[model samples]
Target: MFDKIYDVIVVGAGHAGGEAAAAAANMGSSTLLITMNLQNIGQMSCNPAMGGIAKGQIVREIDALGGYSGIISDETAIQFKMLNKSKGPAMWSPRVQSDRMRFSEEWRLKLERTPNLDFYQEMVGGIVVEDGKIVGVKTSLGLTARGKTVVLTNGTFLNGLIHIGDKQFGGGRAGERASTGITKELTDLGFETGRMKTGTPPRVDGRSLDFSKMEVQPGDVDPEKFSYSSSTKPLTKQRDCHLSYTSPQVHEMLKEGFDRSPMFNGSIKSIGPRYCPSIEDKINRFADKDRHQLFVEPEGWNTVEYYINGFSTSLPEDIQFRALREVAGFEQVKFFRPGYAIEYDYFPPTQLKHTLETKLVSGLFFAGQINGTTGYEEAASQGLMAGINAALLVQEKDPFILKRNEAYIGVLVDDLITKGTEEPYRMFTSRAEYRTLLRQDNADFRLTPKGYDLGLASEERLREMEIKQKKSDAFVGFFTNTSVPPEVLNPILESKDSALVTQSDKMIRPFSRPNITMDDMRKIETVEAFIRENELDTEVLQQAEIQIKYAGYIEKEKNNAEKLNRLEGIKIPENFDYTRLKSLSYEATEKLSKIRPVTVSQASRISGVSPNDISVLLVYMGR
Candidate 1:
C-alpha cells in the first residue's frame, strides 16, 4: 500500500509529536503523523494547564521560534499568569490554565490545516532499517509506510505499565492502551533502554467540593498571553483556582495504605519526578510537616471535573477518596478517577547528538519523554527542534543547533546529551548560567531571527521583532544622550525614596537607581513629552530600562560566555580515539570515548572530564 516515501514520518501525536509534525510540514516537508488513536491527539494527559516556572519561558521561546505551542496555549487559556513578577525580568514566566478539550481541539485543527502533512491511525510496531538508516515504519495492522526520516515522540507509551495501589495494567495513559514492539526492537538493535515513572493526581467532580472552605487563587489582575502573534486575543476574563491544604488527618489516612501503595510495596521500580513527588511519597519524606498545599484547578470552562494538583499518588481508590475527603475543601469530593503512576521506556539521551538524532541510526530521532523529560512545554520544544533538524537533514541542509547562551532549548539539549539524565529532566531558570541574557521578555529578540531565516517564522514576525528592537535601542540612546536637570528628576526620585540628584546628568544615570523605575521617570513632564514624541510602547520602554539598569551584570555574563565559547569553537574529530591519549585519566578517557563529544567544550562538561583534561586536550590540539 506504500507507494511514495514521505520526507518525514513523526510517530505519536502528543505535545512533542504535534510540534514536530507542524514544524516539518510547515518547513515544506511531506510529513506523516502516525498515532495509536487519532481522536486523542494533543490530549493533555495529566493536567489542563500549560507552562510553569522555567517551563513558561520555554513556551515563549517555542513561540518566538515559529512553533505553535504559545499560539495554541493562548487560544485555549482560561486564565493567564506571569509568575515571579515580583522578581527580575529574567525570572518572569508566563503560564496558562487551559480548557482541556479546547487545547486538544486547537492542536488537531491546526495539524489538519497544515500543508504537506497527512495523518494515519496506527500503532508503530517496528522500524524498517537499511544500512544503519531508518527507511520506513511497520504498523500493527500489517501495513508499512516509507519515509526518509522518522522522529519518534512516543510519550509514555513504550512498554508502558500503569500502577494503582497494588493493581497494575499495561497502558500508555489512563484510557489508552500501551504500545509494544518498537522498544524491544530498538533494544535488540543496541540502544540502551531505561524505565522512568511519572504520575498524575486524581480528577474529581468539582461540584461535589465545597469552595467556601478553600482560599481563592485568582489570575493576575493585568494578565498577559503566551503568543507573540497579534492574532491571539488577550485574556479579559479568567477562572479562579482554589487552594486547600491536606491536614495531618489526611496524611494519616494516606499512610494507612502505605503497605499496599505500589511505590512503597516494591511494585514500582522506576524513579518518579523529583520535583513533583507522589502524595504518599511526600508524607513519608517529610514526616514533620503538618499540612501540604493542594491547588484545586478546573479542567475546563464547561467541565465539572477538577484536577487535584499536588495530590498525585498510586494508592488504592478507597484510600485516595478517604484521604482527599479529609482535606479542607474536599470534604465531600466525588471522584472522576483515582490517581495512578505509570512507568515507561526511555533511551539515554547521551546516545543522541545535539540535533536529537541517534548516534547509531541515521535519520532516526527521539523527542519528549522518550528522551526522559517531564513537561508539556519541555516536550514541545524538543519536538520542534527535532522536527526542524530532521526536515533539514532530508533537504541535505546543515542541522540547526542552538547554543546554550542563545536559548533555554539549547541548554536543555546540551545538558541531556552531555551529562545524560539519570532522573527525568525538567527546565528551571537556575539551570541557565546566563539567565539575565535569556529572559522571557527578550526571547523574540534572541531567536525570531533564526526562526525567520529557517523559513519556519514569518516575515511579519520578523518585522515585529525588528520594530521592537529598533524602538528599544532608540529609547536607550535617548536616555544616554539626554540630560535631565535636578528640577526634572529630583522631585520624582525623592517621591520614590531615591537620593536626589545634585546636577543635570544623562537620564540613564538616575534611571540606574534601584528604587527608580521608568514609570517614575515618566511622571516628569520632559520624560512624558519625550515618550510621546518617540511613540515608545510600554514593552519597549521596559526593555530599555532593564538594559540600562542591569548593564553591568549583562556585560559580565556575556564575557564569561565568550570565554567558554572559545572551547566550543574547537571542534573534535568524530570517533576520535580518546584511549590513545595515555596522559588522560582512565575515567576521563572512558567518558570522552563513550560520549564522543562534538566539541572540546562538550567534553569538558562530561562528569569524569575535569578542567585539567580540557587543558590537556587543548595543549594536544595546539601541538
Candidate 2:
C-alpha cells in the first residue's frame, strides 16, 4: 500500500480534511485521507450546527464551487433557517441545525463513495518533505505512504491538551486522543507554531431539562438549504432549540470556580476565540451584567443529549453542575459530559500563499484549525481551496485564486494570508469590503462557472447555475419594461405604508420601494401573471427582486471592485527588494519584504503599509 504514490494526501478527517479529500478526489486526484479514527470523520466537535451571519455566505460559496459541505449539510439537516432575513440581502445567511452523528456519517459515506479517494485509519506522525516539496507522510505505527502533494488539515489535534478546571488531559476532544509528532517535526523544519485554545459547552441530558421555563426558537416558515444541487432538500421537520439565561446567582456560583479555571488562573496562556468565548470568560468580562443568554440545542433527533450553546466553560465538574442547575431550563440538568478548553498548536496563516499552499514547503498545504481559524464553514472553505489548488498543481494547471471582491471565501483567504491572524479567524460580513457583491443568494452565479472550468464542479451544476442566471436576468428585464396600473398597485403600496402612485408606473418602481417585498409584488395581477408565465422558482424570484431593489448599491460596489481588481493586476516581483524603494516607509519596507505580497492591492492591505507607502511602491513600479 505504501509502494504506489498518491496525488494528494490529506491528514485529518475533520470538516476541513473531509472537504479537502472530497474536492481533491472529485477533481481527479488520487487522494488519500489519513485519520486517527475513521468513524469520527466530519465530527461537529464544537457545534452541531452549520452557518451563521457571515459564515452562511461561505457555505453557499463552497456549494457553488462544487464542495460537499453544502450537500452533506443539507442532507443531514434536522432544521434550517435563513439568518438575518430582517437585514439587507447581503446580510442574509442560511444556518442549519444538523443531526451531529448523521452529519459525520454522511460525510464519511460521501468520501467513501467518491472515486480516486481512499481512507486509512491511523495517526500521521509527520510529513515527508524532500528539498521543500512534499513526498509523503509517516504514520505513528512506523508505516509510510507516498504522495506527490500533501495537505495538513489536522484540526485541534496537534499535541492537544484539554483542560477541565485545574485538571489537564492529553486529548483533542472528549473521548478523542491528542495527535502527536507533526507539530514538533514541522517546527523543526522552520515552521512557526503557536498555541490556540477553544472550548465547547457541556452536553446535558435533554430528558432532565425543564422546557416550560425556556423560550422556544423555531425554524423559519420557509427554510432554504445550503446545497445548490437538487440532490438534497430543505428539512420539512425541525427539532426546535430552546433559549435560557444565566442569572446573577448562576454567575456567583461560577465565580467560585474561576480560581481553578485555566483561563483566569493562567494555566492556559493561549488565546481562544474572542467572538465565541467560554461562559466563565463571558461572566468575567461582562461582570456588571445580571444575565447572559443560552441556547439549548439537541445533539440529534434520536438522542436525548442537548448541547449548551452559549454556556461554554472549563470550570470544575461540581461547579459546572451547581451553576448550570441555577439556570431556568437546566434546573435538574444531568450531564452527558463536561465542557473543556483545549490548547492546540496552530500555524499562523501568513506563511501560506493565496492557494493555501505553504511558501516554505512546496506541494504542502494547510487548512482548518491548524491554520488558526475557528468554525466549520471557514475551515471547509479553506480545505476546498487547498484541495483545488493541490490538484491543479499536480495537473499542471493554473492556480485558482479568488479576489476580495469575488467572494466571501476570497475575503477569508486574503485576510488569513495578508493579515495573519494571531487569534482564531472567523468570517463575518463586516470583514468583507465588498459584501454587497458576495451575497448568499448568488454564490452559484458568482462561482459555479469557475468551478466547472476547473473540472471541480459537475456539468449539471454549471448548467443549473446558467439557467438560473438566465431566467433571473430575463425576469429582471421583464420588471424593468413592464408597468402596472394605479388600481392594481396603489392599494398594495398603501398597505405597505409606501407612497402610492397616482398614475401608472413601472412594476419595478413599486417593487424596489422599501417595505415592498417579493411577496407583496406577487399580489399585482401583471407581476403574478408574468411570474406564472415564466415558471420561475422562489430562488429566481428572490434573486431578481434583490437585483432590482439594490441595483444602485450593487453597481456601486461593482465599480469599487473593478478599482481593486486593477491594483490586483499590478504584481510585485518575487524577491523584489523593498529596501531599494527609498520613499517607502521603514515599517512598510520591512512588512512588504517579509510578506512578499503577490499583488499591489494585497500589499496595500497589510497592517503597516500606509497609503503613502503604496504610492511609493506604485511610483517605484512606474505604474
Candidate 3:
C-alpha cells in the first residue's frame, strides 16, 4: 500500500540517492527515498573522507549549485586540508577526513528536516514501466509506490556478491545482504547489464598500533571547509594520520594466499577499478618493488578505529592478519572489519543520455556506483544534476545539461554518456582539457546562475557572486588603464625577479611577466585603496588573478568550445541505416548503430567511429 503519486522516487540512500532526494525535494518536488536500511544513510562505505584531487572540485561545484554534499562533509569532518597548495589554482582541491558515524547521522538529520522529502525503509526490487517509460517501483515487501520519475541509485546492492579468499557469498557490504529481482527484471526488459567489482580495506583498532614508529601526517594548520554555506567554519584543531610502508615480509606473506584469492584465482569474473587496485594486485604487478605505502587514517575524532588504507584485499583472514603484522608499526594490529571485494550489477553508462536518464526508458535515471562511478563526489554531483533535470522534466522545462567546457561535473557526465567507461571512472585535473578556466575557486561564478534559475541556489549567493564579479572586472580594467611608472614599480618588480617595466603598461601583460601580484597593482593608489576597503577573500582574489593572467588561454578555450558546440547542435537521425552507407567502416557502422548517437559530436566520440565515417555522415546530413 502506497501513495497515489510522488513527483520523484529515489531508490537506495547512499551518496547519490541521498543527494537526489534532497535536491528534488529542495526544488519543490514531492520526493520519496527508499532504502533497505535508513540507519546507514550516507555511509562512508569505502573511506572515511570526502573531496580529494579532482573529486574535491566536484564537491565544491555541487555545493555552489546548492547541493548537500559539501555541507554534510563540513559538518562531520574531523580533519580538513587543502590539497596542492603549492600548485596552480586549477589544481587546488579541499579535502576532509570525516567521522564515519557523524557523517551518516548528519545526513539522516538533514534529510529528516528537508521539506517535500519522505523516507521509506524498503528495498526496491523492480521498476513499474508502461509503454517504455518508468512509472514507479516495486519494493521487496510487494509494496508499489508510483512516481512521475524514478532515479535508481542501487549502489553495490543489485545482485551483489562479496568475496574473501576462496569463500564467496551474496552481500552488498560486510554486514548487509544483497538486493535481488531488479537485475533480472531489467534484463528481461532488454536492458543490458554488466558486473563491476570494488573493494575496501580492513578497519583496524587504533589502540592496537604503535604510533611511535610511524611518520605523522597532520592536517593543514589553516584548514578550509568544503561548503559555501554560512553554517560552516574553518577547522581549528586537526587529527594526525600516520604513514607506514609495507615490508618485504608483508609481500611474502600475502603471496601465500594468491592461489585462493578470488580476484587472481578466477573465482571473480567482474572487472574492478584499475586505479585503486588491491594490495595483492599491486604486489603481483610490481613484483620487484620492495615496498608499497599505506596511510593509517583515523575513522573519527571519538572512535578508536582506523582505516588501513592501501591494504584492500580479499585474502583469508589469517593471511591478512599475518601480512598486516609484517608491516612497520603494525605488530599488534586488530581489525574492526575484514577487507573484501564486492561484485554488483551495473548497466554500462553507454545506455544513458546526457541528462542521466536511460535512453531505453523515459523518466528512468541512474546514479552513483550503479552507473559504474566509484567516488562519493562523483555520485553526489551526478545526483544533483540528475535531480535538477528530473524536476525540470516534470515541469515541462528544457533539460539542464552542463557542457564539457562548463565544469568538471560536466566533463564527468559527458564522458560517461558519450565514450562510456569499461572500468570505474574517477575524476582528475588531467581529465579536464580547460582546467585553467575551470578552477575550484570559481565554482560559484561558473554554476550559481544556473542553480539560481533552478531554485537551488539562494539569492544571497547570487548577489555576492555578482558583486565579486563586478569588483574583479573593475579592478582588472583599472590595472590595464592605469599603469605604474618604471621608477615607482621597478624595485618591487625586481624583488620578484620580474623584468623592470620601461613604461606604463598593464600589470598582467607579458611585459610584467612572472611576478605580477596585488602589490604590484598598489603602484596605482586608487587600486591599492580599493583593495584595502574591499579586502576580498583569497579565493576571489585568486580567481580574479587567474582570469587576468590567463585571459588569452581562456578566450582560446571558449572559442574552441564554441566550435565543438556547433557539432553538438547538429542532430543525427536515429536508426538511420548506418549499414547501408558504404563509405563507413564495418566497425563504425556496428558502433553507430548500437550507440545511435544524437549528435555528430557524440558520433565522433564513439570508440570505433573514424573521422572518415563522420565526414560521410556529415555529407549525408547535407551539412
Candidate 4:
C-alpha cells in the first residue's frame, strides 16, 4: 500500500495533524495523514468549544493563513460570542460553542474535499530516519510509508494512562486505545521526553440538569462567526449555557475522594495545566474560596450531552456524582461518563525551530501535545506551520516564519523554542508583547499575502482581504480628510454628554472621541451619504473606526516593534560558542548555548539572558 515516496506524512489526526496534512496537501504536496482511527478525525478531545481570549486571535491567524480551523469552527458552531466587547480592540476575542459532532464531521468533509491529501488508519509507532533526516514512518503493523518529511502530532496518545480515582487504565481518551513505541524510539534517538497530565470534566445528560436552579448564561445578542471567508456564516440562533457553583458542602464531598486522586496520590507524577487545574487541585490550593464557578455548556444542538466546564476532576465515580449533584444546576445530575485525568508523554519544544521542524532531524516536525502546549488553537497553528514548512522543504523553497509583531502565532513559536515549558503551555494575551498591533480584526491584512505567496491561501481569500483593505482604507481616508461643521458634530456629542465642539473639525477628531461611534457618525448626513454611496458593511465601518480611534496607540506599538526588529535582523552564528565571551553571565551563557537562538532578538527574550548579555553580543559582533 505504500509504494510512492510522498512529500509529507502527518501522524495523529487530531487538531494539529488535521491542519498539518491540509496545509501540506493544499500547498500541492502529496501528503498522507495516518491516524489510529479515521472515524475520529478532528475530534474535540477536551472541550466542545474553540477560541477564547488570546486564543481567538490565533484562530483568525490560522484562517488568515488559509487554514480550515476557523472555517470548520464557524460552520459547526451552535453559539458565538465576541468576548471583551467592553475592552479595547486588542482584548476583543471571538469564541464559539460548537456542535461537537458536527465540528468533527465538517473537518473530515473539508479534508476529503482537499486536493493532494490521502488518509490511512494506522498508529505510527516510529519514524524511519535516514542519515539525520526523516524518510518515513513505521506503523504498528510493521509497514513503512515513505515520505520526504514526517510530522508527529500524536496529541496525548503516546503512552497514555488514564486514572479515574483509584482505577487506572491504558487509554488515550475515554474509549480510544493508547499509542506505543514512538516515545521509546525518540528517546533512543537522543530526544528528551517528559510526562504531562490533563483532565476533562464529566458529561451529563441535559435532561438531568436543572437549569432553573442556575444562572442563565445566554449567547451574545449579535454573534460573530470565526471564519473570515465566505464559506461559513454566523449563527442566527444560539443555545443557552448555564452557570452553576460548587459549595462548601460540595467541596467536603469531593475531599472524600482526594485520597485516591491520581493527581493527589503517587499514581500520577506528570505536571498538569497550571490554569485549568483539576477540581481537587483547585480546592486543595484555593481553600479559602467558598465556591468555584462551573459552566454547564451544551455539547451540541441535538445531543443530550452537556459539558461540565470548570468541574474537571479525577475523583472516584461515587464522589464525583455526589459532589456534582450538590451544585446549583446539577441537583439531580446523571453522568454520561465520569471525568478522568490522563497522563501522556511530551517532547520539549526547544528541539523544534520556529517552523516547528526538529533541528536534529531535518525533515522531522513536532506539533500539538507532542510539543507540550495545551489548547486546540495552539496545536492547529503549529500543524499549519509544520505542514507548510514540510512542503516548502520538499519544494526547495525558503521557510515561512511569522515575526513577533506580525502574529500571535509567531509569539507562540518563539516562546516555545526560546523558553521550553515544564508544564502544559497555554497561550495568554499577556504573553504577547505587541497585542495592540496583533488585533484579531487585521489578521487577514497581516497574513493573507504571505499565505498566498506560499501557495497555501487561495486567490479568492487574497481578493477578499484586498477588497476589505481597500474599502476600510478609503473609509479611514474619508474620516481623516473630511471635516464636519459644529452643528453636525455638536448635536451627537451633546447627546452623549461629551464636550460640544465650538468650531468645525476634521471628522476623525470627533470620531476618535470615546463617546462617538460609527453609529453616531452615521447620523451626520454627509457621513451617512458616504457610507450608503460606498456600500460599506459593518466590518469595514468597524475597521475604519478602530484605525481612527486607536491611531496613536497603534502607531506607538508599531514603532516599538520596528525598534525590536533591528535586533531580530542581527543574525547569530548557528554554532557560536557563548563560553568564549568572558563578559557574559554564567546563566546567560548556559541558556544561549543550549537554546541556540538564531538572532539577538530571540536571545534577549530568553529567561536568563539579560540586557548586559545582549550588549555583549552586540559588542562582540561589532554592531
Candidate 5:
C-alpha cells in the first residue's frame, strides 16, 4: 500500500525502536516506524520499572541526546528514587517505578506528535536487498516498504518461543504472537543467529495482598524525575510496595516442578541473564542461604496487578501459588499471570561494526535484544546510536560514534561489538572504566552539545546550557576570588569536622566536600545570595562541587583520553589482514581478525591482543 521511499524505517516499537524512530525522525529524516501491534508500543515486557545503577546514567544520556525515554518515564512514573545516593556522584543513578499502561500511552502519543515519523501497524517479515545492500522491508501482509536504511530492533520477537512448565507457544511476550520470516531470511543471507532466554516473574493482584503483615517501601518525600522537559510532573502520591522473602519451605515446593520445568527438561536450551536468576536457580545455586528477598512492585497506578520480583520461575501454576503463600506477606497472594521464559533469536554483535551496522549487510542495523542486550536502558542507548548513524548514512554524513570515555552508551556498544556476548548482557556500574567522568547528573554537560550539533537537541537546549555554564563559571570564580574570614569560616569548618581556615583563605576546597551544604554557606551571605538568586538545582550544585573537588582527577583523565585518542585516530583499513602480520601472536592475530577493530587503541583493548603485540604493530606502522 506504500510506494514512497523513506529515509529511515524502524521495525518493532519497543524501547530501542521507539527511541530510534524518534531520534531519526526528529533529526529531520522521513522515518516510518512499523510494528506488529501499535497499541503495545513501548511495552515493558519484563518489568514496570526503568533505570538502575549504570542503566540510569544511560537514560539521562538518552535524555540529553534528544531521546524520549527519560521524558516518557518521568511522565508515567508511579514512584521515583535516586539509587546509590549514599555513594559517589558517579554511582548516583535515577530510578523509577512506572505506571506501565500510561508509559506505553505516553510513548505512543509522543511518537504521534513527532514530525517526520509515520506509524504503520504490521509485522515486517523480511528485508528486501539489492546488490548486497538493504533497500527496503517486506511485511507479513505481503507489502514492501522502501527505505534508505532500516534499523531492526525486533526485541525478543523474532521466532519467539515461550515456555511455561511443559507448555510451549509462539509469542514475543505472554499473550503476544511471535514474529517470523526476518530471522530466517537474514540467516539465509549468511548472517549467524543464536538464541537467548529471558524470564518475567508472575503478576500478582495487589487487592488480595495483606499490607499489615509486610514492610512498606515508599518513594522519596520529594520525588525527582529523569526528564529535562518540564511537561511531566513528579508523582504526588505513590503506592507502597511490600517486601517478602523466600523460605526453605517455599524452595522445597518449587523443586517439585523440576521434572516439568522447561529450563531443566530438554524442552528449551538458551542462556538467560546471569545477574537476575529465577527463584529456583537461586535456591539451587545458593543452597546454603535460607532466604532470598522479593519485592512486591505495582504494575501500574490504576491496575491492581503487582510484579513479584525475585520470584521468577518456569514452574507450574499450582506450585507457584503454593510457594508464594509460604513467603512472608504473600499469604493471600493472587496471581494475575504465571511467570514464564521466552527464547528468541539474536545475532552475535561481533558481526556488526561499532556503528551498529552489520559488517555483512550494508544499510542494515540491529539493536536492543537483537544484539543480545537485556535492559531497557541498554536497548534504548543502542537504538539512539543506530538511528542517528542510519540517518547520517542517508544524509551522506560521517557516522556518530561515541568512545568509552564519551558516554556509557559508548562503553556499552563497545563492549558488545568487541567481546560478542554469549549470554544476555545487562549494564552495571562496574562495567564502565571511566565512570568517574560519566556521572548521570552531568550527562547534559557531556552530551547536550553533541546532540545539538547533530540536530537532535534543540537550539533552546544549547542556549540554556550556555547560560548554566556561564552562571556556574561565575559562581566558581566568585568562590575562588572571594575569601571567607577565619572567624566566620572557623566555626562552620569546625562544625563540619574540617580544619579552620587561617586569615582570608578560600573556602572553595573545604566547601567541595559532600558534608558541606548550603546551610553552612549561609554564614557567608554572598555565597548564599548567589545560590538563592540563581535558583540553582541541587544536582547542578552537586555537579559543580564534584567538578571543583575532582578537578585534578578529571584533568588527568582528559590527558589520558587525549593520549588514547591519538591511537584511536589512526584508522585501520577495513581489509587489513592481521593473519599476514608476522609480528602479532597467533592468538592476537586470530582475535584481531575476528573483531577487526577500527583503531589501534581498540585493538590494544581486545582481550587476546596484548600490549606487546600492539607495540610491535605500532613499530611496524612506524608510529
Candidate 6:
C-alpha cells in the first residue's frame, strides 16, 4: 500500500516512461515509475540503434534539454555515424548502433541513481480519477498508489493483440503479456481511442550468416556521439553492419505464405508505419522490383544475436526461414524467433494540449505510442516535455511550451496537437520549416537556457553553451574584420577551385565561396594564427563557418519565423465558439471547434482552416 502522495506517477517503463520519471524527479518532484518488468526498462524492442535523419536531431535536442536519451545512447553505442555528411550542416544527423543489453542496463542504472524517484513492478490496471482529475493509480495487485499527477506512456500495451501467421494472441510485445483495464477505463471517461500496428524483423543467430557475400557498412572514420555531456565516452572501435538483398526467388517464397500472412489475410486491420512497411507489403506494392535491400545489424557487443533489418513480416515461421535462406548472406540463416506484427490501442492526440495533457482530464498526460507516435526519439522527447509540464503544473508554474522555430521538439508537439496523425507519425527533416535555425549543432544554443530555467538542465550545460556561443561569435567577428592580401589568400582559393580575390579583401568575403571551408582559410598564415590565438574547438569553428557561409538564408528564415511568431502570440480564448461565426466555412468551423486551437497560428495549420479563415479571424480579433 502507498501512503504518501507522489508528485508524479509514470506508467510504463519504455523510453517515454523512463524519461518522464527522470525529468520529474530531477526537477525536485517525488516520482514513482510503475512497470510490469524492470528488466526491460529501456529495451530496444524494434532495433538496437538510436538516431537517424531527423530523429538524430531530436535526440540531440533532448540531450540539450537535459534528457538522458543521448547520454545513454552514446554510453552503449557499438557503432557511430553522422548521416547525411555530404549534405548541408542542417541535414547532418548523429546516429549510433547501441549494445542492446547495455542500453537497457544503463537506463535502469541511471534511473536508480536519480533523486526523488522510486520504482515499482506492477501492472497499472486503472487510474484513480475524481471529478475529471487524476489522483492516483490502481495496480493489478489490488493496491492503490496515490499521486498528484499521472503520465501514461503505456507503449503498445493497451489491449494489445499480436499476430504471427494465422495464429493470434493477446500480448504487448514478444513474450510479454498484454495490459488491460486502462484503455477501457479511459474510453469510458470520454476519451477517443483507435488502433495502430507496428512490427519488427526476426532476430537471427549471427554465426549462421555468411558475411563474404555481403557488403560491409562500417561506422564513420571520425565517430561523433549523441550526448554533449562528459558522462558518455566517445566510440573508438565500432562493429560493422552488412548490406544484403532479397532476390525475386526470395520474394516468391515470401509470397507463398500470403494466405497465412496476418497482414494480407485481414487479421490485422490497423495501419502500420507508412515509411517502414512490411516485406510482404513492400513486395505487394512494388511488384515490378526484383530485389529489396536488408541491413544485417548486430544486437550487441557480446551477444550472438543479429537483427535482420528490412525483412519485417508476419508470414509463417517456415515461410520466413525458407525465404531468408535465398538471400545473399543468409544462405544458411537460423532464426531466434519469427517476426510478428502487433496492433495496440492509441488515443487521438487532437484531444490533448501542446503540454500533452488531456483537455478532458486535468492532472493527467499522455505520451509516446499512446499519442500515436512511432520512433523512440519522438516518444522520448514527448516524455521529456510532458514530464516537465507535469512538474510545472504541480508547482503552480506556467506550462513549458516550445515554439516551432526554437526546437524540433516544438515542431513535433505542434504537428501532433494541430494536425492529429492518421497513421503512426515519424520525424523527418522536411517537417521543420526553420531547420537551418534548428540544426543539431545549435540545439544547446536554442534550448539550454530554457532547460536550465526549468531546473532540469544543469548549470554546467548552460556554461558550456555560453562558452561555445562566445567563441563562435568571436570567430565570426574576426573573419568580418580581418582582411587578407590576395597574395596570401589567392593560392588557397585557387587550390580549392574557387575564383582568386583580385585585391586584399575581408576574409569572410573569400570564405563564402563554394567548396571553400574553414580549413582552407586556416591554410592562410593570418587566419591560422588567429585560430591558434583564439583556441577555438572544432564545434565552435564549425558553428562560426556555417553562420558566415549561410548568413543570407539564415537571416531570411529568421524573418519568416518572426512573422509567423506574431500569429502564435495572438492567443485564442479556450472556450471560443467557432460555430457562432457564420462567415467561417462549415468545415473550418467544425475542425476549429474540434481541435480547439490555443493560438491563431495553430488554427491556421489545421487542414480544413483556410488562409482566408485566418484573415477573417485576425480582423475579428482587431489585429
- Tell me which of candidates 5 and 6 scores higher on lDDT: 6
What residue runs in model 4 are displaced by over 4 Å at the alpha carbon? Answer: none
lDDT of residue 379 for candidate 1: 96
| Candidate scoring better on TM-score of 2 and 3 | 2
TM-score of 6: 0.99
Judge candidate 1 at residue 482 and give its lDDT: 93
Question: Which runs of model 1 end up more than 4 angstroms from their true locations?
Answer: none
Question: Which of 3 and 6 is the better model by TM-score?
Answer: 6
Per-candidate total of colliding backbone pairs: 0, 0, 0, 0, 0, 0
Between prediction 1 and prediction 5, the one with superior lDDT is: 1
lDDT of 2 by residue, 171-257 (tens): 888999999999988999889999999999999899999999999998988888999998888778888999999999999999999
Positional deviation of 553 in candidate 5, in angstroms? 2.8
lDDT of 6 by residue, 1-623 (tens): 67699999999989999999999999999999999999999878898999999999999999998999999999899999999989998999999998999999999999999999999999999999998899999999999999999999999999999988999999999999999999999999999999999999999999999999999999999887888776677798999999999999999999999999989888899999999999999999999999999999999999999998899888888999999999987888998999999999999999999999999999999999999999999999999999999999999999999999999999999999999998999999999999999998988899889889999889998998898899999989999999889999888877877887789999889888768888888898877787789888778888999999999989999999999999999999989998778889999999999999999999999998999999889988889
In model 3, the worst 10-residue window by lDDT is 506-515
- Please, what are the lDDT tens digits per residue for candidate 1 over residues 1-623? 66789999999999999999999999999999999998888999998999989999899899999999999999999999899989988898889999999999999999999999999998999998999999999999979999999999999999999999889999999989999999988998899999999999999999999999999999999888888778897799999999999988999999999999989989999989999999999999999998999999998899999998999999998999999999987888899999999999999999999999999999999999999999999999999999999999999999999988999999999999999998889999999998998988899999999999888889999998999999899888988999988888888887888888789999989899888888887887777887899788767887999899999999999999998899889999997898878889899998888889999988988998988888889888892
**lDDT tens readout by residue for model 3, 430-471:** 999878768788888899898898998889888877887887
Write one digit per residue (lDDT tens) for candidate 5, span 178-261: 999998889988898999998989998888888777788898888888976545677788877778788889889998998889
lDDT of each: 0.93, 0.92, 0.87, 0.92, 0.88, 0.93
**Least lDDT summed over 10 consecutive residues: which range in candidate 4?**
225-234
Error of 6 at 14 (Å): 0.5
